[model samples]
Structures are given as structure tokens and as C-alpha cells.
Target: MQHSVMEEGTAYEPPTYDETFPVLPESASSSSGRLNIFSINNNLQLGRITITQMFRVPGEERKFDHSDKFGERESIRTCKTIMKETNTIIEIATSKDQSLTFLITGKQNQVLEAKRRILTTFQTQASKQISIPKDHHRWILGKQGQRLKDLEKTTATKINVPSVQDQSDTITITGTKEGIEKAEHEIRVISDEQI
Candidate 1:
């Protein structure tokens, strides 16, 4: 015979990113230039804080450059080319089409500028439905979610990845518009590379 078990309220509060660090103030709308210096400065003040943002645009859009041979470049070359074209920080990793995720961090305006540059370079358009796959979700999530955690620390964007059992494909990227675009492009680029 087995004894019945009793459930108790958890006294252990879950750890949180907010509680672990200080936050930056929102950037003023009046700032000039493509990059928002105030926001960037705020992030810098927050102990090397960089913003993680994502964007959703049409996938097929791009600026035509007949001079460069993108297909001929190596993986590192391709990553460098993408970074150079976007004018923002980038990291490349291998994954399936649906599993790729781009993580970006910087000032609000800088992040936005980066998104625009990347979109233009790739010639992608915003799509109503983003069919992100199941297997690739792990690359964005990283081991124990520490990759995303690091991204959050720098970009200040709250990134949520569904558990393996969740069966949901959408990776919720919460941040400023610029941040969203940057992150989304990175994801798409990585996915394209894998393909």
C-alpha cells in the first residue's frame, strides 16, 4: 500500500531577470539620427546593456545588388556580409529553416537602423503568418535558456520560448519595433543559411 501525498504551497519564489538587475529609462521620441543616443547611453549605463529586438517584415523583399556573389561566400563570409549590410551586431549558428533565431542588442535607434538596413539588404517583406518550425526552436532557446538570458541582459527585451512539449511555433519577442526587426531578420537569415 502507498501513502497519499499532500501538496504544499511553494515558498520558493522563482528567480527573475527584473529582480536581478536595474532597468534603463525609455528613450525620448525627439532624438535625431538613425540611432537613438539617449537610449544607447541608457543601455550603456546599465552595465553594458544592449537591447534585444525583433522585426517581422515581408520575407521576399530586398535591394538588388548584382555585384556581390552571396551564394559563393563561406559561412563566416556570409555572416560577416549580413552583419556588414545591417550595421548591427550579429551571431550565426546552424539550425533548420524554422529553428533559426537571430539575437541582437544595441540602442533603440541603432537597433531600428540595423533592422531597416538588414531588411533592405535581404529584400524581404513582412508576412502575416510566420510559420516557424518545431525543431529549430531549441537554437533560439539555447541550453537551459542561458543564450536567451544573455540576450535579455544586453538588449533588455523579454524573449519567451515555448517548451518542447508546448507544440507552439511562435517565439514571442517583446521589445521596441527596432529591436523586433533586428531580431527577426537575424532569425530569418540564420534559417536561410541552414537551408
Candidate 2:
């Protein structure tokens, strides 16, 4: 079969890096030596998105209770670093009504990471603490803390059982209400086990 090499007097040419995309600057990486995304594929998702989060501090006096509010305005300012780590930009506006408005924008992954980090960092989260006998701490911790790790993963919580040396009886569970409940229940059950 005889076929023409070119159609419409135009021949196919493979795309060069410069043609397909722009050249990335060498200053992409920070001093910490983190690997930055130099360039993204043309067809790949740049992953841009915007998210808004609203927070209300309890009581109008703004007495600055740790559990009821996002903390003093200065503390909240420190959390901005978390957003920068994820390459997200944020604008926070506060009103006399004791409400805070957060506007975050960035790549999809960046936005999501920043959102979760910011909430867990500044937002008032639920926590539960239980007293487990010092002797039973080993059982809950298991060998090398594997059991505790598993329980934490399942419950989606951070369980802080004081070091065996500290002589502390409190097993503090910090996370969502559901997570705290699950972890607390599981801990009590484990401690009650006869084995």
C-alpha cells in the first residue's frame, strides 16, 4: 500500500521538553534539601484547589481558653508554617463575633494536607484520658508497642500512655470523639483481660 508520509504538508515532530513545558528554575529546593516538584507533565494534573474553614471560639469575651478556642492570635500565627510546608497560601480573617475564617488555596494535595494539618494543629479537638494500672501498661503497649500502634491506627487517635518510668497513670487519647471513645473502650477491655 502506498501512503503519503506527510498530511496537509505537515510532518509529525516529537515534542521537546522546552516545547511541551517551561524550564524549571534551579532554586526550587529549599535549604532543608527537600525534593521540590521542578515541573509537572502537560497532561498531568496541576492539582489546584481552594478551601475555606470556619472556626468559632467559645464565649464572646475571648478569654483565650485553650480547649474552647484556636488559642491566642499569636499561637495561630505559628501554624501558618504548616501551610507553607505544603506549598499552600492561606488568609485568616477574624471578626468581633468570635469566629475565624480561613481561606486556603494551592495544589490539590497541598490543600488537603494543609487543611488537615491546620485543623489538627489549631482547631479544638476532642480528647479522653483513662487511668490504667502501671502493671497493665505493658499489656496495652504489647511487644515493641505494636499492639498500641495497631489500636491507634484502628481508632484514628494519638494515645499517650506515659512512659513506664514516669509513674503516670493517665492514658490520654487525643482525637475525634469517635476515635477517643473507640480507643478508650479498647484500652479498658484490654486492661480487663484475665490473660
Candidate 3:
């Protein structure tokens, strides 16, 4: 039977030793079917020193059963969660193993913040917030809302600019802690540029 061995599970088999007289070449052996293979990789002479071997684990092997269905299911679940939880619409690309890459488009700052938050929340398990000044808010928000829109698109964070009547100078950032820091830092930098 043809079988492929994978590095998984817990089963060990010791290799049998050759105790007989050495009358033949090293390429020939009679023992457990562990194939020790050696070859000169490329045309270089020094490549002959390294040896490679293929081993068969009696019953341990990996079979990939799910293909597109598994990835689609995971993507759907993640998309649903992202839509329901946040005010952002994001496109998801998933690998066969259910890994995700988000292609998000929205306000520049919001997007950047969101990406930052998503990365940090899943990768670093951190959370935080940042505040932006009202005067500098115009810079972050930009002229005719273009600059602000650009900020949202770049940061991936929803930038909440309080109305003149709100009497608040702080622009609230909602996303992952790292994202918040990044968005906040960018806005501050923009503010500094105006001065």
C-alpha cells in the first residue's frame, strides 16, 4: 500500500540496527522500511555530504477534508460578526486553514484604526482609547470633510467629531488599542503640521 507520513500524533518506532558483517555497500540494508535517501543536490560536490530520509509512520497521516466550504464558512462567520459589531464594512480573504486577511475601505482614519484594533485584539489582546483636541479636529476631519475622510480611510478607525453644540474637544476613537494609539498619533501629527 502507498502511504504518506505526516508529522502528527503520538506513535514511535525505533529503527533496527544492522549487526551483520559489512560485506556490501551502505546503500543496501535489511531492516524496518525506513528509506534513508542521499543525493547530490545541484551540481556542487559539497552537496554530497548532506543526507535526507523518508520515514513512514504506520497510521499517522493528515487528510485535508475541507476545501472551499471551510474557508467560506469561516469568512461568512467573521463577516457577520464584523458587520454586526462595528460600523465598518470589510472584505475578507481566507486561507484554506481559516486564516483571514481583511480588505477594509471606509473613512481613512476609521479603516486604519479598525485594522489596527483587529490586529491587536486578536494578536496582542490589548484595548485602549485616545482623545483628540477640538481645534485640531478640523485638521483630522479636513476641509469639506475630505481630509477627515482620508484620515478615516487610512486609519480604519471611526472618528467621532463632536458637534459645536456638544461642547467637547475630544474626538473619540473606537477600535483595538494599538489602532487607537496609531490613529491618535496620526491625528496629532496632522495637527502639529498645521501649527
Stronger candidate by TM-score (1 vs 3): 3
lDDT of 1 by residue, 1-195 (tens): 996555686465655865674344463353332444443343446423467775443222322345333333353465466567545676523233322234555755556555544443444333222446767766666788776665543443456667888998877765544455656665565456556
Instruction: Provide the lowest-lDDT 10-residue window in model 3.
Output: 54-63
Candidate 1 structure, TM-score to reference:
0.32
On lDDT, the candidate that comes out on top is 2
TM-score of 3: 0.40
- TM-scores of all models? 0.32, 0.39, 0.40
Report residue 159 deviation for candidate 3 (angstroms). 1.1
Q: What lDDT does model 2 reach?
A: 0.68
lDDT of 3: 0.53
Q: Cα lDDT of all candidates, in order?
A: 0.51, 0.68, 0.53
How much lDDT does candidate 1 score?
Answer: 0.51
By the lDDT metric, which is better: model 2 or model 3? 2
